[model samples]
Target: QAAERLRLSARTMHRMLRVARTIADLAGAADIATPHLSEALGYRGIALAGTRDAA
Candidate 1:
């Protein structure tokens, strides 16, 4: 759902998941949580904001 809203590509979504996994690992979480995913997406939004493809 969030991916659809952000119009992220499959590769982008995979990157987000990797980021989320890293976040979860840093937080000592056994599994990825919503907050981790949200934070990853937030970072993605920030990264995209400076580009011509921002939406």
Candidate 2:
């Protein structure tokens, strides 16, 4: 779902996971969740709403 929404490649998917994991760790969360993944993807140009076509 995250990958599809972001239109990212498989390798980027893995990178997003790692980044989300780190975010959770820094925030002292026991696990990665939707918001964590959301933020990570957002940094890579994936909006949560997915409505914007372009810049």
Candidate 3:
């Protein structure tokens, strides 16, 4: 996982704004926006859903 690999706490890693900024750039945006945040949140939600299903 990101925490083990990066040697950071999961909470710290999850809160990284730099990753959100990069995600926005990858989406071809000039600036980070609400859509970018929503997209990121969606991914996290999907991931959590998968984890819950497995459990």
Candidate 4:
């Protein structure tokens, strides 16, 4: 779904999952829910955009 929606590669998908899993764990969740995924992706987008602006 992410690959279709965002044109993401397998490696990127794995990385996103890792981040989402960590986020969910930190929040005391038993699983990586959609909200966790959304938040992880949102943070990544912000960091990427910030670096571009800085450059």
Best by lDDT: 1
Candidate with the larger lDDT of 2 and 4 = 4
What is the number of backbone collisions in each predicted candidate, taken in the order shown?
0, 0, 0, 0
Which parts of model 3 have CA positions greater than 4 angstroms off?
A: 1-19
Pitting candidate 2 against candidate 3, the one with the higher lDDT is: 2
TM per prediction: 0.83, 0.71, 0.59, 0.83
**How well is each residue in 1-55 modelled by candidate 2, as lDDT tens digits?**
7578658898989988999999999999999999998888777665535547653
Sum up the clashes in candidate 1.
0
**Model 3 over residues 1-55: C-alpha lDDT tens digits?**
5447657566745654466677889988889787776666566668779999999
Worst 10 residues of 1 by lDDT: 46-55
The predicted structure with the larger lDDT, 1 or 2, is 1
TM-score of decoy 4:
0.83
Which 10-residue span in candidate 4 carries the lowest summed lDDT?
1-10
Clashes of 4: 0
lDDT of every model, 2 decimals: 0.92, 0.82, 0.69, 0.89
Candidate that beats the other on TM-score, 1 or 3, i.e. the better one: 1
